[model samples]
Target: MENEMRSANTEPLHKPLGSSRTFPHFEGLLFSPVQLVKKSLADDVPVDIETKIGPHARRPLKLSMPIMISAMGYGVALSKSFSIALARGTAMAGTAFNTGQGPVLKEHRDNAKFMVVQYHGAFWRPTVHQLGQADMIEIRLGQGANAGAGTVVKVTDLPPDVLADFLATTHEMVDKPLKELVVPPGIPEIRTQSDLRQLIHHLRLAGHGVPIAVKLAASNYLETEMEMALRAGADVIVIDGAQAGTHGSPAILVDDFGLPTLAALCRADDYLRLNRRRDHVSLVVSGRIRTPGDMLKALALGADAVYIASAALFATAHKQVLKPLPFEPPTQIAWVNGTHASDFSIDEGADSLARFLTSSSEELKSGIRALGKRSLREVDRSDLVAWDSEVARITGLPLV
Candidate 1:
């Protein structure tokens, strides 16, 4: 009877629909290795992993590694300790940490050697004075997890200190009751192309030559989006694909929206090359880029750099994840207001995360040597081949 019931209750997970299983992602594509004839003499010599974002800027954002800590905000998604730890860890790795749609905190800024501040639809928009503090400013247009949607967090779930900080930074509490904090779908002020251009101009002046980046979810019309961003005077374009993670988002949106990371990268790269804007605007890709191989592949496909959030969070929670055990998700340890949030040690987190970054970067350099390349710029489409026909067609790469 138990076996019969179990059989009856079983459901199709990979393909719940008639033919489609949500949207396709990076699982279908892979990097084809070349190990026969051409090989690097610098296998023993150190490879140059250093990267620059927004090369056209008077001063570009330089990173020791091509991988950067992606946005996971304080109060909104992560605890203050976790945020600071992430910042310090990336600083140790000589990369940047992004403040994801959260209010900029002094603790994060102090710890982060390079900071990417996200100007989101949330009420906590940074003031002109605060904008000047950022190494890079990202105008978040949409996210992979919830492409055209917004999120709401209740004030009741917030701690007193966090609530106080939020109130101090934003105008929501002054205008409305603190029952719930709402983030609108898009920046209400940015309605048209002219508005976008004007906002970018103002942000450029406020940031004092810091790179102004535009972050967008990977969509079918991504080429148009890239053109629009460039026209609006964006220095960098960040694309987060469907496989990207978020603290909380509707299941439908997460599963059904946006293009896969690989498709987005190839399409965007092709568009940039065609228009001769590839060098003028920096391209940064993210979403499910967990391994060093994925990072290297992205760079080869035309991404100047890659962003990592979920992987870094997992690295930070290396040992502490066990504290939650079978009862709760490991993420609870780093989550704000989580039961195990207090158990997360900032020192341990930073150390583990920095170590992970170092090891991953080493692995990337080794891969570059295998490809017979001295630097990242030398590693391009010729260094890569597709595993299957679909991938080959989409990427315009030779099939293995």
Candidate 2:
């Protein structure tokens, strides 16, 4: 069906949702539980699921659990109501919410406990005051779904409020409103390592010492990119793998580019360790990480935390998807341009998402206790074993 659609259209097939392709994930990896030799933590024993990103930074991003809500932009991706729900939900769960490649929505900042603002390659730049409000600043060079692809949103398509915000934040005054807003593939100011270093320095100063993160698509040149980002003084590095979700990315880019999450995480972990920089900079990995087990496995393999978008979106919508069921797709309730977007209930969505995060965190704590560990920091590669030989080879874990 997808191939038929591609054949019919001259333009690249634009998938309105995430990638349909399946990548090798953490399913082949199993956690090693303790029983006889090493005793598991008692049921009553408290487990600390707290996580700190960019620990060495003056203002590290601290969360109650090792899960964060990944970037799902307002206007471009999610509706205003959905974005605010995500903010409230993350706050309720005691985690952080990221303002994606869209205009900074004041409501998101107002409701979120911790806000990570993306410094993206878009026409509109956040004001200095907006930067100061961030818990972390993520420089989005590329993402797993689209890599360096640019986005073009027709001005007429944007909601009135979103359009106003965009015009207000634009760097220069336009005699007339732009016909469209184009977000470039790369930051115009950053052409070299030195340029990146300077930008990070400037952001650090502007953000009043908050962590400066560099988010990159997990690629074959992962190590080289990591080196450049580290040299630029990035306090945290986010490796978004091939399985990462996107609102609207071309089918070819979604299916044919980037490394899988498990491979990317292992390679990144090894690079950081070998260079003795693991302790200095935090590592956050995201891509098809849905369940608590996946999150735990990511942490064991050396990710400081995990980010979730698809999962969070589903959780937020919960049974409310019935509103757009049968006739319309479920995402129509949450997407910015969706037919039923205005019908989305912010309070209900927030509650549902918060419950999901809390439940997932509890499950992670249970897994930690089963491993005879009381804290997330105690989890390591040794706590995991691979069922597949290929998985074993990639993760350096023994095969059962």
| Winner by TM-score | 2
CA deviation > 4 Å runs, candidate 1: 1-36, 171-176
lDDT, candidate 2, equals: 0.90
Tens digit of per-residue lDDT, candidate 1, span 1-400: 3355446755322211111233334444565556567645466876898999998876689899999988787887898899999999999999999998767898888999999988877777777777898899999888777786776777888888888777778745477567876677867788887888998898888888889999998999899888888999999999988878887776567777888888899899999999999889999999888899889889989999999988998999999999998899788898888889999999999999999999999999888887777787888888777766777778888777
> Across residues 1-400, which tens digit of lDDT does each residue of candidate 2 receive?
9899989988888775457776667999998878997989887899998889989889899899999999898877888999999999999999998999888878988899999999987768677889999999999988898877777777787778778877778776678758888888868879999999999999999899999999999999999999999999999999999988898888888888899999999999999999999899999999999999999999999999999999999999998899998899999999887888989999999999999999999999899999998999999998999998889888888999
Could you tell me which 10 consecutive residues in candidate 1 have the lowest summed lDDT? Answer: 11-20
How many clashing pairs does model 1 include? 0
Q: For model 1, what is the error of residue 365's alpha carbon versus the real structure, in angstroms, after optimal superposition? A: 0.3
Q: What's the lDDT for all of these models?
A: 0.83, 0.90
- For each candidate in turn, the TM-score is 0.92, 0.98
lDDT assessment of candidate 1: 0.83
The Cα RMSD of model 1 versus the native structure comes to: 4.5
Residue 334 of model 1, lDDT score: 86
Off by over 4 Å in 2: none
